[model samples]
Structures are given as C-alpha cells and as structure tokens.
Target: MNQVIRNTALSAAISLSLLGTARADDAKDIDTVVVTANRSAVPADEVLASVTVIERSDIEASQAPDLLSLLARQAGMDLVRTGGPGQTNTLFLRGGIASHTLVLIDGIRVNSANQGNFDFAHLPLSQIERIEIVRGPRAALWGSDAIGGVIHIFTRDPSAGYIEARAGSYGLGGLNAGFGTAHVAIGAGFETQRGFSATNPAAGPGSYDPDNDGYTNRNLSLRVHGDVGTQHVALTGLITDADVEFDIGETAAINRELGIVLWGEINDRWSHSITLGHNSEDLNTPDFDSHFGSERSTLDWVNTFTLNADNTLNLGANWAHETGFSESSTEVSFDEGRRNLAVFASWRGHFGTQTFELSARRDDNSQFDGATTGNAAWGLDVNDSLRVRASWGQGFRAPNFNELYYPGFFGFFAGNPDLRPERSISQEIGVDWLATLSQRVSVSLYRTRVRDLIAFTSPTFGAENVNRAAIDGAELDYHFEHGAFRLDGNATWQDARNALTDLPLLRRPDRKLSLSGSYRFSNDAALGLDASAYSSRPDIGGDLPGYARFDLRGSLPLTAGWTLEARIENVFDREYQLLEGYNTPGRSGVVNLRWNGK
Candidate 1:
C-alpha cells in the first residue's frame, strides 16, 4: 500500500511538471456531440448525466491493446481480468455488480442471456470508432441490466483507408486493415499471443500452472449507410471468433451482430427511426465438453417531436426475444427463453438557463412481472461558465437463465425456479466548471440502494433473492489543453458494501486515480504517459493488494502516408493483480507500423 501511494504521487508530480513546461498554444474548441446521454443527439456539455466520450483519435493515441484497457482509465469503473488476453474480463460500474451494466454495439444489446454479462476481452480496438460511457442508473430509458449505467460502442464508419501490423512482447502479433468509400466500409483484424500462466502458482496447488496459455482471434465488420430519397438507411454486421487455452481446458467462442436502421425527418417538428438488430454468442469448452449459446433479437421504433426551440418529446417502443441453452458432460443442462415488450417516453424542456428532463419506461416480460422505471433530472447553466445538475432514477436487472433454471448436478449445485429481479434506486448531483477555454473540471456525488440481490446460499446451494447493497460514491474529473500539451485525469472514491454484512463488494476498489498526458513535438511527433493507481479490495479468494502502473507511448511520422507507433507498458515493471489468483502482464513493448490513405 505504501508503494502504491508513492507511485501515485510520483505520477501526479510528473504530470504537473509536464504541464508547467508545456508550450503555450491556443487550444481548439471541440464541441463533442453524444447520443447515449439521451436517446437523441445532444451536446455533451449540456447533458445532465456524467458522461465520457472516447474518440478514435484518443484511442489511437493511447495505444491501448484492447477495449478493457481503454475503459479502465475512465472514472466510476472497476475492471477485473482473471488472466492475460482472452481471459474472463469483468467490469463493475458505479460499484454495481458485473452484470448490472448494459453494453450496446450500434444500439443493439449484446449481453448473454445465460450469464447476463458481456465479455470485453474479444472486442478489438481496430474495429471501434468511438465509445460513450454514461455513469449512474439509466434503466429509465434503456430498460433492464442498466442498473449501473450504459456503454455504447460505435463501430468504424466509412472514412480514409488504413492498414497496420504490430508485434509485441510475449510473442504477441497482429494485423488490422480497413478501407472505406463514401457509403461503405469494411474492417478486419487478427491477433495471436502466447500469454503467461493465467493462475499464479502461489494461489494454491490446484491453481498452479507453469505452461503458457495461448490465444487467437479473428474478427470482421461491415458498415454501409446512404440516403434514400428523404430517409437515411444503414446496415451493419460484425463477427468475431476466439480460441483460448487454459491450464487444464480450452475454450472457443463465436460472436455475431447484425443491425438495420432507417431514419428521416417527417416534418420540421418531427422525425422518426426504426432499428432491427440481432446479437448472439456461442461458446464451447472442449476439455469439459460444455457448450453455452445465447441470442437476442430486437426491434425498436422511436419518434422525436420538437415541440419548440426549448422543448422536445421522445416516444419509443421496443420488443425483444432472448434464448439461452447450456449443456455439460455431467449430465447437467439448461434451456430457457423469454420475451419482452417495452414502451418509453421522455420530455425535455429548456427554460432560460435551466433544463428539465423526465423519462419513464415499462417493460412487460413473459417470464416475470412487469418492471417500471423512471428518471427525473434538472440542470442549470450558471452564467455560461458553470453548470449544476441533479437527478434521481430507478433501475433493475432481470434474473439470468443460470440463476433461474440451471439443473442441479450430483446433488450439489441447483437453481431456483422462483427468483425476482434485483432493483435499485439512485440519486446524483454534479457540477461542471469551464474554468477557461483550455481547462475544465467536473465533480459528482451519488448514492444508490439495491434490493433483492440474487445469491447462492445454504440449504440447496441454489440462487435466492436475499441480499441488499448500499453504495456511496464521488468523482472528480479534470481536463486541460494548452497549445501542444494536453492532460486529463480523474479520481474516484466509493464505499460499496453489503447492507446485511457491511462487507465490501468483490473486486471493487475503494479508491482509484488515473492520469494521462501528451506533448506534441514541432516535428509532428507525440509522446504520452498514462498512469493509474487502485486501492486494495476483497476478491473471492482473499484481499487483493493495492498497486500502480505506468505506460509510455509515442508516435512518429515517416514517409508519405506511413507512420510508426510504439508503447512500453508497465514502464516501472510494477507487479499488480486485478484478480487474486491471476497473474498480470509485466514490462512489455509493442511496435506498430501503419500506412494511411489520407
């Protein structure tokens, strides 16, 4: 813990020193537009919720290896990886459980119905254009599984063509290429690595493994959009397949998504959109002879009416069908299906400097009772430089197939036929200050109470609704850009505990801090530093230790359209563990060469 604190302080000092020596330049004003904060496009600065927008430029500049690595820098997020690449990745948002957050790709839900969580390990950075993270409860507009918040990933769009190849430590190598015309684009990527042992030998005799674990992935995506008369239409498809080797078993997974969207203006005051989508996953464990498959098909139609310059009305209806299936060599099996129909509405009113938003949703499920959620928020812009916002919302997470229908094996493990969804109510207040054109700051405070949490307990060792949680949290985010240097940082403090036991939630650190800074050179080259620290937290195995890590990145332009990028991760050779029994990556470097068609 002392070492962790020292490292964090050193990182802060480095960032501050860089800022002091940075060249003075006029920072450009970028007005980020986002849709996840609301169902419609809105300026990020005007949104009432805590939101983070990560663009393609930022993604490339950071040189992060995967989606999980990039998301770990954000506030209010706790990431736990069981091992190296291709391992089990779990994210707890706003101190909520791993399954409480909703994940979407192009507005289509992708979480598995069996486990109720989406794996971020296989989502490559090469195919993603941007990511929008909204913190706090969003179920009022998005429905179940949004008790924590929402992460919406937008795939790459048609733009300049590019191709790249990379090689890193631990026998890591990959290729990524993309090409696009005015209305169509395609992207493909392949990655393979001989990773270190996933489980540490010190954990236990049963978990000891000296051999290396290997991983391989192949992914492809296609996107097309065009204007047909007065309406715009888009079609998107993505597929990914991955194979992973563990100590005693091997697993393979295939994931797919398809979407068709159409939208257009009906008049000066009204516009509408229709989206049809499908997401599915098929996973197999060869050594265990186990298989799990899940799929979700959805339809959504939304209409927006501009009542006036200061007011708007949004109405939408959604329908979805989900199914899950699983089988194991132990003669255990699970098969279940469910359907949901939902209707939602929201009203936004801007009165002078104060803005008001109210949204509600009702989800009627085939297997359980209906769930209704709502959100009310108000924001006030004070003299154009300061803003204050407050909001209250209700959210829920439905029971997954494994918790409700899994068949007992060897008279040991069982499932409860009767289970209720977990529910939560949350409230938050925030303040944003644009101290200057080159500096901005945001602070937020929140509290949440959750009830009817599912847990496996004594008696039958089956799932039951017997737990509750109380979470209180705070966040501070800062951004500064002066001339050729830029800095961004955030700090999070959360107390997430079980109400009955007063125990800390698993793998949720009580404190987290991150800092990222970059300096641009006169020759068009750039150097960046990324550092983070996390406090110790309890895991299933035991109390994991606190740690800190740093990464160095740089890029240089070469001939014509070619460029070279490189990153040295774990610059200090800091040893850390996100999970109690899993080993983490050590000092490693990756070099990438790319040719752009711009």
Candidate 2:
C-alpha cells in the first residue's frame, strides 16, 4: 500500500474501533518498554527485531483461558494442541520448529532438554506480570535454541494487598491473592477448568477414543527482592501441577523452578549482573506406568563497560548442566546428562544516522565439540519518523535426550545416540514507521535455512540427521489509537518447505492474520473484539482445512478497585483442527471479578 493510503487507513480505523481499548496516546503507554531486545530496557520503537508485549492489563481485558490461547493469536506464531488446557502444546515461531524458539522465565531457560520444548499449557497467565516476545534469530547473544526467537516471561510482584475470584464455563473457578511492601513482595494464584474432549471421532485407522478429555491445573508463584548498600538481590519461584486425560490415558505433570540473582553497579563506568537458577519437571502416565523427568541448573554472569558516549561493550559467560531420566513398566530405567559452558561478547556503536551491533558466542559441550556462532546488524535512521535495519545470524539446536538416548527396545522405535545438532543461517530486513504520534507500522522479510535437521530413519525408526528445510516469510504489524478507540493487527505470509521434497512442513500455515479492536465507554469500562484466520496446512496424516475464529470481551467497573470482566470465545462456533486428531472448543464463555489494591 502507498504510504499516504496506509496512513489514511490507520487514521480511519481508529474512528471505527472492541475491550481492545488503547490508552489514548497520552495515558499510561506513550512509551513502551521492552527487555528481550538487548537484555536491557529499550523502547519498542527503537528495537530492531519484531517484538510483541502482552501486559497484565491486556490479559485481564481479554480473559483468555490460558497462555497458549493468547499466544496463538499473536503475529508470527502457530500453535497445535491435542485438547484444551493441560494438553501437549507445541509452538512454532516464523515457521521454525518447536525446538527452534528459546523460552525463559525470569532470565532462566525453561525448555526441557528431554522433550526439547516448554509446556506452555501449564503456564498460567494469572501468575505472569508481563511477556516479551522478540522475533528472529538471537543465538549470537543467547546461544542454542534461539534460531527463531526468544520469549521472556516475568513473574508478577505485588505492591499491595490484592485478590480475585472467578468462574467460567465447564467447571472453572479460581482464587488469586497477593501482598507486598517496598522491599518485599509475593503473589500466588490457583485455577482449574474441566475441558472438552481431546480426540476426533473418526481418527486415523484405529486411533479413536470417545470421551471428554478433562484437565486440572494448579499453580503458585512468589517473588521477593531487597537491596543493600551498593548491591541488590532477588529470588523467584514457580510451581505448576496438572492432571490431563488424553486419547489413551491420563498423565500427571509437574514443573518446579527457582531463580536467584545478585548484582549492582561496580563503579560508574562498569555494571554487572549475576544469576543462578534451577528447573525440573516430572511427568507420569499411570495407564502405561511410564515416567519421564528432567532437571537443569544454570549460572550466568555479565559485565557491561561504557567505552564512550556512543559506544558500549558487554561480556558474559554461562554454565549449565542438565540430566534426564525415563522409566516404564516394560523397559528399564535410563538416565543421561550433559554439561556445557559458553562465553559471549557484544558491541554496540552509534554514529551519525546509523547504529551498528556485532555479537559472537562459543559453547563447549561435554557430549560434543565446541560450536561458535555470530551475528551482525545495522540500523539506519532515515528521519525522525522512520528506521530501517538488516541483519544476519547463525544458530543451532542440540538434540534432546528423547532423540539421542531414549532406549526403545521395541523393534518399531529406537534412539540414535550419535545424532548431531541442527544448524541454521538466517537473514532479515525490516523497516519501522512512526507515521503519526499514535500510529505505527512495520514490515519485515526474512529467510532461514536449516541443515542437519533431525528425523526418524525410515526402517529403524531411529533419529538421524536426514532432512533439511528452508523457510521464507514476510510480516506486517500495525497499531493505532485515537479518542475512545484502539486497533492492533498483524499479518504473516510464509513458505516453509522441505529442502528436497518441497512439501510444506507439518502444521505450519502458509498465511495467518489477526485483528483486535477495543472501544472504551469510560475510563474503566470497555468492549473488545478479536478475530483470527489461518490458512490450510499439512498435518501428520493429512491436510487440515483453514478456519477463522472470533471472540468478544467486555470489562465494567463493579465497585471501588474492583472490575467485572467477561468473554465469549469462538463466537461463531467454528469447527477447526490445528492437529490431525484434535478437537477445538466451540462457543465457550468465562467471567471474572478482580480487585486491585494499591
């Protein structure tokens, strides 16, 4: 679209605006702060990578059932789940595989080395303060599993006494409470829902189970921090337990994690931050009497030196050790572990009309040889209203324990202990615009090629580096806000195909679009609408048809410091399948009441 026409559309859309209400350009959000961009607070307009932030207010306004559902509607993201909350959920960012995107909680890595993925289904939004998602490869600064993007989750901290209670469709109810002071804070919540059936009636050949696949989840979190003379310290913890029934049987899953940090400005020119964290998960299937568990401990230290007014340098080192074990009634218990150490450096320089960045990292693994990755980027400020950037990066993903060391005695399935890590090269170009004081737009194009992709061998059914792929995509994001209304939307078109077969990668839609709008009746009340469309794509056994879904939400002030909120999801009752044999919810509703004490 022409610049004039696009600007006109942005201006026109605001008059037309849903509870999706904007803060009117002058209120609480005139300046957006993000941390995932450079490990420091940077304005979203100044970031080079595609970024999205979902704040606590956004979550409370939308009333999304879970974290996964909200993320599925975000730009450059695709999600597949077998059932409702507590199901096995997989997320793909910009056509990257499930393992390509790195996930962190309060600066601690959360992906499991056994499954090569994080359990988004079990992550409750009530416990999250804010979420920052950065799109594009970041391996140069973050190391492995960042070939696609990075998602950072910050747990909430309470400033005053607060509480909430709610109930929803299909046996949903929960309670949340928090209390805190200037130097000490704590927040905790608990919620549960009985979900819909998980399986399709007419599944493949003989894989059919007709029953409601209900689920139960419980979660708790705490955050506390204090400061001493010239130093600061903090500790954070989270635990979630779930019981879910799938097509075959019931499984219990538990995740527990803790993070600690101590850091401060050593001197005027130098600052340092140090972090230590531990994460563990335990899963059990009672029917088959199977168990899979993993534990990981990590430490990181970083120092920043100010070279001059326009130049800065950062040096960091990280160490991590992970262990995994699996046991079943029929098979003997097996345990495997690996350790790695990494060092990285990044330089940022600002000159007239231009900003430059360069970063490199090296990791030495106990199970394999050392690997090195690097990235370079340049940003040109065309004027006060526009900025353009280009970047190139290299990344890699280590094989998970299930892929390399899971001992399967059965003739049909086995592991390949010698499998190698998948590696990739990526490039992208983008332009950001601030056409008006309250309107913004961005366009980005990117391509990534991955070699040494791991797959199961045809006959032995063991993991091997037998496949390669190339993915190319373009994205557009727009945000506009005027009096009494707000509009946010994004669209993506991608071609993710097998390098040799040329077939579309499984479950990656070719096109996806989302739009949300909110209209405020007053300062404390609003009505919002959301819409999502996904193009047809390949699945495990066949192709799934394309579909669109709509949701309605509203918020109203009930009393002092209390609000009443409600939402109806799948308003049209569209029938869709994100996975081959999975069923999605149809026309569900939820209501919540909350109190914010300051």
Candidate 3:
C-alpha cells in the first residue's frame, strides 16, 4: 500500500509539471462562464478551483441516454444506477458518500430533501446544453451536501430552432422538437424506454427472467428568454412522468414517478430562481405480500448578485415536506420538513506575478436545529501554466425520514429520533499543468475526517443507524487532444476506514481507472473507444471479483442536417456487481438517426 501511494504521488507530480508547459501553448482567449459556482459569469480558465466541462459535442459522441451513464464515463466518478430505465441513481466522488454530491439544474438544486439524493435516470439528456463538474469539498460555496462535489447542468437556450425524432430497440422511441429565435423560444420532448429483468432460471423462486421487465417515460419542457434594456430575462418549466415494471426474482414490481420544475432568471449579474417538484415511489413485493409507497414535495429558491468584477455573492433557501404510507395499515406514516439557508462570496485579484482567488460560504440547516456549517478555498496561479489550489470545507447531512420513523417487520423495529446529522471536515491541495496546446493534466491529494458518519449497524430484527468513519484519497487526470484525435484518462485511489472499528468501509473500492480515445476518420465520420477497470471490493457476506468493461462509438454525417450514430456497450460482456443483487446489462448495440433543423 505504501509503495502504491508513493508511486501515485510521483506520477501526479510529474503529470502536473508536464501540464504546466502544455497549457501555456494551448491557451486561448475565451468568454466567461456563467455558472452557479459563484452565481455569476466569470472567465472559465480564471476560476481558482478544479472544474471539468462536457460540451454538447461530447454528449453526442458518447451516445448515452442519461446523465448517470455519461458522468460515470468521466474520470474520478463512481455511479450506480439500479437495474434499467426509471430506476434510482447515485454518484460517489473522491471517497465521499453517494448522498454527499449535490446536483443542480440551471442554478436550482434538484436533490430531494427527504430522500437525500437525485434521480439521475429521470433527467433527459436531449435538453442539456452542457455539464460542469467541480470536484472536492465545495460546502463553502454551495453548502450542505457538497461534501463530495457539485454537478451543474445547463439546458439549451432558445437561440436557434431545432426538431428531431428517433426510434430504436426495446420499444425505445423519442421525439424532440423545439424552436427559438433570439427573444422568443419554446420547445418540448418525449421519450419511451422498455426495461428487462435478469434473473437465473435455475435459482428457483429467487430466480427470474432477465428480459421481461418494461418501462415507459415521457417529458415536456418549455423555455423563454428576452432582453429588457440592460437586463436579461429567462424562464423555464418542465414536467416528467414514468411507469416501470421492475422484476425481482419471480415477482414483478410496478413503480411510478411524477416530477415538475419551474425556474426564472433576470439580468446578467443578478438573478433569482425557484423550483417546486414532487415525486412518489410505489413498490410491490410478492414474496413479502406487502406494498410500499413514499411521496415527497420540495420548494427551493436561489438568488445571486455580482457585487463587482472582483467580488460575487449568492443566497439560497429551500423547504421540503415528505410522507410515506404502507398498504398493511400500520401507523407508519410521518410528515417531515427541512429548511436550509446559505450565503457565499468569492473574489479574484492579482498579486504581483501571481493571480489569487478566495472564496467562503456559510450554511444553516433547520433539520439539525439550526446547525451552522462553513467552508473556504483559495488558489494561486504561480505562473501562466502552473497553478496551485487549497480548500477546506465542512459538510453535513440530516438523517433521512426512513431512518427516523420507519417501523421494522413484526413490530420489532423502531426509529431513532436522537440521531445527529453526519458531519465532515475535508481538505485538499492540488496542482494543474497545461502540458501542451492540446494536452492538460492535474493532480490532487485530499483527506476527509467525518464525524457521526451515518450507517446501519447490526440488522437482526431491524438495522441500527449510527455514525462512524473517515476517508482519504488521491486523484489524477490527464487529457491530450490534437485536431481529430484525443486521449484522456483518470485514476482514483482511496481508503475508507471505520473510525470506531478500524475496519474498511463496506462497498468502497480501493482503485478505479478509466481511459478513452477518439479518432476522426474523415470530415464526416469518427470512431471512439472507452475502457474502465475497478479493483475488487470486500463484501461482508459475498465475494465480488474485480471487473473491467469497454465500449465503442461511431458517428457518420449522412447529410447537411442528418447524421448516423452507433454505440456498442459492454464490449467484453464482463459481468460485475456494483451493488449486491443488482446486475448490469450485457452486450448491446444502439443505432440512432439524428437531424438538426437549422
């Protein structure tokens, strides 16, 4: 282990040095990035923190259905999507828990206050303009769940008009049509996907068919933008619903979800956004002869102000209410509410030959009885290509409603109302290098000490909820691009140990690596390949071996407005389990025909 750590550190240092020289040669003049990071538009390359961007072109080339699959393909990211379409999804970064990652749409938080996570499967990819990912603790800037990092999604604006329709395997069909002309624009999209169950037939009652489950989903969105004198105005609304049949062993469970979001923005330097949404998850288990349902509603508001060219500030507040019910007629129903308020500030200035940035934020959570948390980060550009950054932040997560009110089977289970919010103090230091005009590299070492880490203890009649543990890790990423060919990869090594028992954290792997490359065959055609490998993880009761998988993508421009795209996933058909009892799909191919109406 020591040798591995040493090797990683040395490699990181060398990569950073090479990247520095490369960035100087590849530097280009670009516009400022308008993001929720600081609630304003700022020069992308000027930001003092580590941020990764995925443009629309990257998404089209990847040919993934949802954000989870696309993000999973990125470096230093771990994603779990249960079964197929319409299932729940979660992401883990830099050894942080799944719930520690915060997700934002336009500038509003999409994470469920009650469930403590976002359902990535429900987010449509067709409407996204771009995705920006910031790694490491960002609680000081975003607050609360930003212990791991932040993922902000920007939807396409109505600057141009477009319409497209596509159909594929497994009852899959889609239609996306929208129009926009500078001041006025509107559009809508719909999609339907079929699901399948995968269970071994030889396993008797515990076994089921892997190709019988099905799912259907639909979505509608409208957006408008206009300029009013010196101020800009924007409005967006979305509604989505899904019905799915998920197979569990010999039984089939039906699930449905409905969600809505409305957001507005005004002016370039000042804006406010709000979101009101609801979701319900219903499940049926034939073996237990029981039916379960959980429902939740959320309201969020965020405001931003650019104090000046060197200063920016942001304020956010949100409230949520949730309830659960069971068909067994037990008093398992409860009403829960959560409120959060936060303030943050960031500044950039130059000191001699070096550019510097300072940022800080404070957050208060009502669920924890007004507990206050804060974080701060600073960065220094040693030169045009050499930059160093350090950050320290505190993050917290309130116990879920199920952990506090759910009753166990046979009336033997009970909820814990005395549980405290899990908290963590994280610190990281990293360097960035622009190795060449078409190459970049970065490395970071981080440590997070968490207190009251929430986890389920002994599960005899019911599981016991408790807090305990710490996680530390390092990450490295490198990218090289030259005209029609590009090479990129990232590796992450981590150690998560239980503070109390001195045992390794369950389900957390020690090593993860991913690499991808793409080549353009002609002005109208391109081919891409991706590969990922994960080390074995110790299971408390099961044996899970290491696994690796590969994927291939190809695209050909057929006409001025139409294109042909194909993707082959699970190229090697390596069967692996990211989570117990959940198996991923095998080799599959998808061909899509896309048209962009100018």
Candidate 4:
C-alpha cells in the first residue's frame, strides 16, 4: 500500500509539471466558478480546499442511471453494494466510515435517522442539475455527520426545452422530458430497471441465473418556477417507487418516497426555502418468517439574509416524525420522533491582496438525550496562487430505533434512553496552483479525531455504540485542457486507524485513483475514456485483492437536433467484487438516441 501510494503521487507530480510547461503555449480562456463551500460564493481558485464540480453536460455524457454509479468512479471515493441493483449502497470518502460522510440535496439533509446512512442508489439522475463534492472535513460548515466530507446535490431548474426516450438491456426503459419558458418552467422523468438475482443469498447453484430474479423501479418528478411580481418563486416535487423480489427465496420489498421543495428570492438580499418529504419501506420475507415496515416524514425550512455585500447570515430549523409497526406472528408496534434546529452565519470579503472567510453554526437535537453541537471555520488567500484554510467543529448522531429496541436470539433488546451523541473534531489545509490558463492543480491534507464513534459490539442483546479513532488523508487533483482534448485526474491516500488498537478501519481503502480524457474529432463527434483503481481494502477478516477497470464512451451528431451515444463499461471484463458474496456485472454495452428541440 505504501509503495502504491508513493508511485501514484510521484506520477501525479510529474504529470502536473509536464502539463504546466505545455499549458503556457496552448491555453484557453474559461470562466472560473464561484461555489458556496464556506456558506458564501467565492472564486473556486481562491478557496483553500479540494473540491470537484460535475456539470450537467458531464453528467449527461456519462450515461449513468443514478448519482451513486456516477460518483463511484471518482477518485478519493469508494462505493460498496451487495448486488447488482436495489441493494443497499454505501459511500466512503477519504477512507472514513460510510456513516461519517454527509449527503445533502439542495441543502436538505438526506441521511436517514434510523438507517445511519444514505442510500445513494435511490437518487434519480434525470433531476440532477449538478453536483459539488468537497473532499475533506467540512463539519465546520455543515455541522454534524461531516467528519469525512460533504456531497451536495442540486436539482435542475429548466432553462430550456428537452425530451428523450430510451430502452436497452435488462428490461430497462426510460422517458425524460422538460420545458422552460421565459416566465415559467415544468419538467418530469421516469426510469425502470429489471434487476437480476445474481446476489440472492438463498439461491442454489443454478438459481443464480441473472434473468430469473427481477426488480423494477419507477420515478416521477415535477418542477415549476415563475416570478411572483418582484420575487422569484420555485417549487419542485418528486415521487419514486421501487419493488424487488428474489427468485430463489420468497422475499420481497417495496419502497416509496414523496418530496416537495419551495424556494424563492424575496428581493435581492433576502431569500428562504422550505422542504417537506415522506418515505416508506415495506419488506416481507417468508424465509426468515419476518414482515416489517417503516415510514418517515420530514419538514425543514431555511432563511438566508445578506447582512451586507460581504457578510451573510442563515437560519434553519427542522422537524421529523418516524412511526412503524412490525409483525412476525404476534403484533408489535414502534413509534419514534426527532427534531433538530440550527442557526449559522458567515462572512467573506477581501482585505487588500488577502481574502478571508469565517463561519459558525450551532445545532440542537431532541432524541437519544438532547445535545447541542457547534462548528467554526476560517480561510485566507495569502496571494493569487496560494491559500490557507483551517477549521474545527463538533458533530453528533443519535441512536436509531432498531439499535435501541429489537428482538434478538438470546433476549429482547432494551432501549438506552441515556445514550449520548457521537462526536468528532476535524482540521485541514490545502494549496491551489493555477500554473497556467489551461492547467490547474490542488492538494489538500486533512485529519479528523472522533469520540464516541457509533458501533455495534457483542456481549449484550442491546446496542453498544462507541467511537475511538482518527482518520487522516491527502487529496490531489489536476485538470488540463488544450484545443479539442482535455485530461483530468485525481488521487487520494488515507489512513484510518483505531486510536487504541491501531488497526485499520474495515471497508476503507488506503488508496484510490481516477483518470479520464476526452477528445472532440469534429463539431459533430467526440470520444471519451475513463479508468479507476482501488487498493488496500480489507476482506471479511483480511486484506482483499485490488483491481482496476476501464470504460469508453462516444457521441455522434446525426442531424440538426439528433445524436447517437454509445458506451462500453468494463472493457477488459475484469472480475472484481465491491461487496462480499456479490458479483459485479461483466462487460456491457449501451446505445442511446437523443434530440434537442432547441
């Protein structure tokens, strides 16, 4: 693992140096982006953090069905799943525990209060406008569950008209359409996938047939936006339904979710947004003689006020209710509720040649014993090409209902009403270099020390959640574009160990790397290639072998408004497993046809 990390780092350094020299002669002019990484929009090059932005065009070109699959290919990140589709998928950032990472949809927390993690598989790709990933400690800005990093998903607000229909392998079919006028806009999309039974635990030898076990998922969404006199108002609603069955066993599950969001600009300096959502999951397993279900409803509101051109203030509050009933033979019921409130403010401005940012937040929760959390961050741009950032914060998570009350083999588990929230403190520093107009490179180093980390231990029928570990890592990213071709690469090396045992964390890889290049043959044709590698993963009780995979994609414009797209994944047919007892799909091909009304 040490050798691999050293080699990759050396290679990245060499590449960056070479690209810097070549960039001076053939550089193209492009606009820099301003991101809200510190609760305010600042020049991307001036931020002392490592960040990656995936634009809408990049998402469309990837041809992925969901955000999980798309982000899995990114460097410094690892994705694990138990099966081909509809299975639980987890994301690991910078070698942190899956639960340590935070996911946000339009600034609304998406992590489940009961599950302890977010299911990235359920997020629809059609509704996404862009994604901004900050690959390091961001707890100072986001508060809790951000000990590792933060991934913010932004949904699309139609600015143009488009419609598309596609069908392919695995009984997959989809319809995506949207329209936007000067004053108003509306859009909707849907997708279905017939999943196979490759990972059925109860399946016999021949029962592993990929076509036998079938699963289907459906999603629908609607978005509307218009101006209310001098104020801009927008509303978005989405509904998703998924059903899956295992062919070898009489087990099935169904999930449904509905979400609505409202946001608007109340004048130039004031704005507010509110979101309401509900989700339900029902499962039936004759093999285990268990039938269970759960439902959750959430309401969140945020208000933003510009105290001036250089200072901003934000206030947010949320309430959630979770209730469910389960039955095996006799009937048993359960009910749980949680509420959270947070207030935060930030300031950003320039003092001569130096730019600075500062932010602080406080959170209060009502569940598993009420606790208050706070966070703060500060950053400075020393010069046009150098910046420094540091942050410290506290974050916590409450115990879930299942962990507190559930029936076990030996006895009935007891709920611990006195449980405490898990907490962590994090710090990071980074440097950004724009060697030339066409070449940019960034490196960031971060470390996080956690206390009362959540975990399940033996010796009792009840839960024992504890945290005792530290995670440290470094991230390197480079981007170069010249003429009709572009190249981008990113790599990360992380070390997460038990504070007492000094043992590596389970399921977290020590190294990750990704590289991609794209070239435009002409005004109507383009080709792209991507590759990724992972190392230092621990198997059930030992180390697992590492592997790499490659993918190729191309596009051809056929006519004025028509185009054809093709993609080949796992071109070498590499055999690897991201989840134990589950097999990944072999080589596959997909072709799509698209049209632009504009």
- For all candidates in order, the CA lDDT equals 0.84, 0.80, 0.62, 0.63
Candidate ranking (TM-score, best to worst): 1, 2, 4, 3
TM-score of 1: 0.94
Tell me the deviation in Å of residue 116 in model 4.
2.2
Model 2 spans with C-alpha error above 4 angstroms: 1-31, 329-331
Q: Report the lDDT of model 3 for residue 596.
A: 71
Ranking by lDDT: 1, 2, 4, 3
Write candidate 2's Cα lDDT for 96-209 as tens digits: 988999998877888998988898988878777678888998888887899989987777766566788888887788888888776566667777776677878656645567
Q: Number of clashing residue pairs in every model?
A: 1, 8, 13, 3
Q: For each candidate, C-alpha RMSD in Å?
A: 8.5, 7.2, 8.6, 8.8
Where is model 3 more than 4 Å wrong at Cα?
1-34, 163-171, 181-187, 200-211, 249-332, 346-348, 353-362, 459-465
Q: Where is model 4 more than 4 Å wrong at Cα? A: 1-36, 137-143, 167-171, 179-197, 200-213, 246-309, 315-330, 409-415
lDDT of 1 by residue, 1-598 (tens): 1233222111111110011110112111122555676776566787899999898778888889889999988999989987889988899899998889999888888888999999999889988877889998889888999988999887765357888899999899999898878677788999999988998876688666878888999999887776679666778888999998887788999999998877666777777778889999999997878998999999988787878778878898999999998987665497789999999998988899999999999999998897999999999999789999999999999998888888766655577868988999999999999888789999999999999999988877788999999999999999999999999999999999999999988889999999999999998899999999999999886888999999999999998888899999999999888877788999999999987776
TM-score of each: 0.94, 0.93, 0.82, 0.84
